[model samples]
Target: MDAPTNIQVEVSLGRKKTALLRSLKMPLTLSFPPSPPPTVRDVKRAIQKAFPKFYADRQKLSLPEAPKSLSDDSVLLFDAAGKVELVVGDLGPQISWRTVFIVEYAGPLLIHPLLYHLPTAFYRTEVQHSALQKSIYAMVLVHFIKRELETVFVHRFSHSTMPLFNIFKNSGHYWVLSGLLLAVDAYRPGYSQPVVAGTWRDGPLLQLGWAIWAYAELSNLIVHLNLRSLRPAGTTTRTVPVGYGFSAPFNLSFPNYFFETLAWGAVFLISASPAAALFIAVSFGQMLIWAQKKHRAYKKEFGDKYPRNRKAIVPYII
Candidate 1:
């Protein structure tokens, strides 16, 4: 089959019509020819070529009618053009991915604790506290705090800037879910019952749940640290992560996600809240999707060197 020819594209930068026409001597319209249709990145490059003053990475190309900026670098120009009018602008401000993660996690860590102290209409009386309830609070707090710390100290993000709106979206997701899980578990009438109440609060089961939670949390931290050590600071390098200790046999593509699910599953088991279990299921589902994407990416990037035996998020099931 014959290869596809490049499609011609005309791009305009910035919003001020009068200012752009008056201040700029060069022609605003520029044509781009890219094989298989150009991406947003190609459009930005064309803009940069026509007008040397504009930075490609800093530019936000969009359809004028759209409410949000066109941020996807991989989107074909032809696909976007059919949807709306193409327009380009300078991205006003940017924040790092690490900062976004920290902020998102911090919201839940801070807001979840307030449910216990704050006078909310949800509880007719002050929510009665128990040793188990207090333990749950401590674990939840530590979980988020650990994530925040890891984002700052351990995780190295390749893409520096995320969509500015994502910070708010992500923060809202974590904050709302954390509150929902904690509130449901803490204030529910069943939680107020003593440990002597049947098999639900059996001593051995509670101990087992705690053990699973601790192991998963610690294992996840180790996996993250090991992954971090693979790539040195101030560099972008890909390395195959070799499992060690408890992780040695699995050869899972994303053991971190697996451990994360286990940690939340442990919490769900301990809390015995259907809502909490549902949240864990939703989270695991999302993580599985991402893990599969990562697995494909690794295969594409490393080819034969990448472990073919590795499953996405599970040892053998997935």
Candidate 2:
């Protein structure tokens, strides 16, 4: 009948049938200030401290009666009539999203040049890499370098961590599909030779591709910088970014994705390789999915304040 002194959260494995009863019987009680109720993250941390095996990333906490996991910042409500039970599901091994990006990008950063210089390692006879191949190599290197720098310094991730197994899956996508496959095809004998064989090393298409690639690369950087400006360093806070460069119209929710797609398209145009084509196709598809989700979040978060005309990853015709 009197005001509650402190809330108690009983931890249990959500999937078990006897979880609720076991939790109530043997509860892992955590004390918190009544002024600010304990958040989901606070509860998870408490559970992790009590059970070392259940780290924050591995813990999916929810009310015993609720079907959905609680958001990290969601405050736990105390019940006067009954026990407060927190269900935790182990999400398996996990790693930081930043680590995942660095590891995956490292694949292409190292593999591209290795395959270019030491073709025999990949079971290909060495042919002198043409100026075009060198040029394409430079572009890909620059692209990945920018990605690494952004991951390390510029971009802020919304999600703190991801499943550990994703490192292999992501690395394979970057290493095998984007790096090795593209390099093998692009650096193959006679694949990148000049149109005039020797004298015209830098063909018109090569020049045009370089121009497009450079423009797209710089545009992508601008968009990234703008996005970074929305969120301060060391925080995941976000705001609607001011338009610049290709995103001047603010028509695309993910203008950076668009620019990267264009940049890869330029790489394909220059190399004229099937691997580059395939990589861009796969990359675009993934980016499109991410963009759609982000777009929906933006609309939901900002409501009518968010632009109604904005597309997900394209200018006007996503």
Candidate number of the best lDDT? 2
Clashing pairs in 2: none
- Cα RMSD of all models vs. native, in order, equals 8.2, 3.3
Give candidate 1's whole-model lDDT: 0.70
Taking the candidates one at a time, how many backbone clashes does each contain?
A: 0, 0
What is the RMSD of candidate 2?
Answer: 3.3
lDDT (tens digit, per residue) of candidate 1 on 1-318: 433343545455445544433444433554445444567777777776766665565567777566376654556545433322366766534567988898888876776666656625555555556545665777788898899889988998766776677888877767667655656555554565454255455567778888999999998999899888888887667787776422447778888999898888887777777767776777788898899898899989899988777887888878
Query: Against the true structure, what is each candidate's TM-score?
Result: 0.72, 0.89
| Backbone clashes in model 1 | 0
Clashing pairs in 1: none
